[model samples]
Target: MSGKKCKHCGSSEIEVDPARGDAVCTNCGSVLEDNIIVSEVEFQENAHGGSSAIGQFVSAESKGGASGFGRAYVGIGQESREVTLRKAREGITALCQQLRLNQQCIDIACNFFKMALSRHLTIGRPANLTQAACVYMTCRTEGTAHLLIDISDALQICCYQLGRIYFKLSRKLCINIPPTGKCFFLYHKVANERAAT
Candidate 1:
């Protein structure tokens, strides 16, 4: 494409076949390029005369798909755990951004969520509750000037419910979070004053 011409016939008309991994010159009927690498997924014809994809779509964040945590196939109208986790992660990120938390806090919250997921603690629990608890844990551990009530208000959930989940998540994860101190409040006040100016 960058001023390339066929050596055999000096023709610039070329056709690329990604599936065959070759580029052919249209005018001269000669191979212009070969042994090209393709990243696309291959497909095959099924017995029912329909084309089916050859592989499953695995996410970079998913460690469970290849580890046999569960089957890769999901029935119709159902979703895989990886999809659920991805959605939960997006929700966590959105909530953190809305609260104007730093990236470190968001990363820590996602890590906590993953840990809770691996431990099977998220079973029988609401996804939003788990997400809120993870963010609260991040705030506590990272010494961020955010409170459970603040997170509850952002999520529009009851503060009591969020508090219960936060305590339970911390206990289950064996994380001993320090109580909110006067320095944290002062830090928030100073940060707000600086931002105002």
Candidate 2:
């Protein structure tokens, strides 16, 4: 819409992806999916605005009221009390090690990638359901042991839709998200349900 160029490869072919809520570069094929899941924090504000305590509080409170306030307060208040980038980078270092990613360059890369994904994935979106789907896919691809129900319920969407969205988003992001270690957990739950029938 803004006729912007690609940030990754500098291509001039850019458009907004409704599914991911990101501005994508079709030419060089940059996914640019950072902004999709940002509402999860509920208290994060960019330099340009649109996310703030007052705005997020109204939306979050509407979702679950006090519980939402508690969550937002925890997120934002925790951010305010921290040393900021120093601690964040340390955590990122640990995450990189766990994922076998390059600790040296992965922090900023991961931040940029996640931020882009959060922005793009949630465009014209209502809930953090897409974010949950993305996290499930991330866990699956990363082989983490987190369960799908844990992911789906946390995101407030059904498992089937989560799976569909995950694959669809993966295709859009040009990323491969293998079923996570918890994939077996989901399969087992399904098996149990079928057995009851």
Candidate 3:
């Protein structure tokens, strides 16, 4: 099933609750169902007052729970939702440190990044460099505008180092991040579409 967006936060944090037959937003604890779907899909007004919350999806597959995205390792495993969420939060926080993103944005971005990478990469634990690249690419795609130089500085490496990271991640993930100019074109296309009726 497709991932549902959150009604309150306009985040794609919705997950299906089999018991309730409704999709619930894990980010803001919002229940999105029925007629609320229309408003939920609308762009939420934030300080930026734009479509900052891109229409994306968050599925159980993204979290390695199902849809055959990634397999959970038992070296450290949990059977409860609380523990899993805590672990995910912690991992995301560390990844944010690497990517220079704030905590709140990191969780959601990481969710999407992992899913996209899993859809293309081979089965294996990605290296730190690969993870850093995925995080950087994600931030760029999500409109963070953080420069690669700034990201490299935060990672305590040269700008070229992160470029290498991005390249290696692209190789490992088997997904090519389009050129910046191409990405700009695609972004404008989406923006224009959003601007039109």
The Cα local distance difference test for each model comes to: 0.79, 0.51, 0.53
> What TM-score would every model get versus the actual structure?
0.57, 0.34, 0.36
Question: lDDT order of candidates, best first?
Answer: 1, 3, 2
> Model 1: per-residue lDDT, tens digit, 1-197?
45789999998888886545568989989987654544587887879998755434344555534212423334322346666678778989999999999888888998899899889898888899899999999988987788787799898998998888889889999998988878877777788689899
- C-alpha RMSD of each candidate structure in angstroms: 15.8, 19.1, 20.6
Q: Clashing residue pairs, candidate 3? A: none
Model 1: residues with Cα > 4 Å off, grouped in runs: 1-79, 182-197
TM-score order of candidates, best first? 1, 3, 2
Residues 111-190, model 2: lDDT tens digits: 43365344465345433445455454555565555565666655446888767665666677767656344567777688
> Model 3 over residues 36-68: C-alpha lDDT tens digits?
111143344567765433223224334433221
The clash tally of candidate 3 reads 0
Which scores better on lDDT, 1 or 3? 1
lDDT of 3 at 122: 17
Worst 10 residues of 2 by lDDT: 54-63
TM-score of 2: 0.34
Worst 10 residues of 1 by lDDT: 64-73
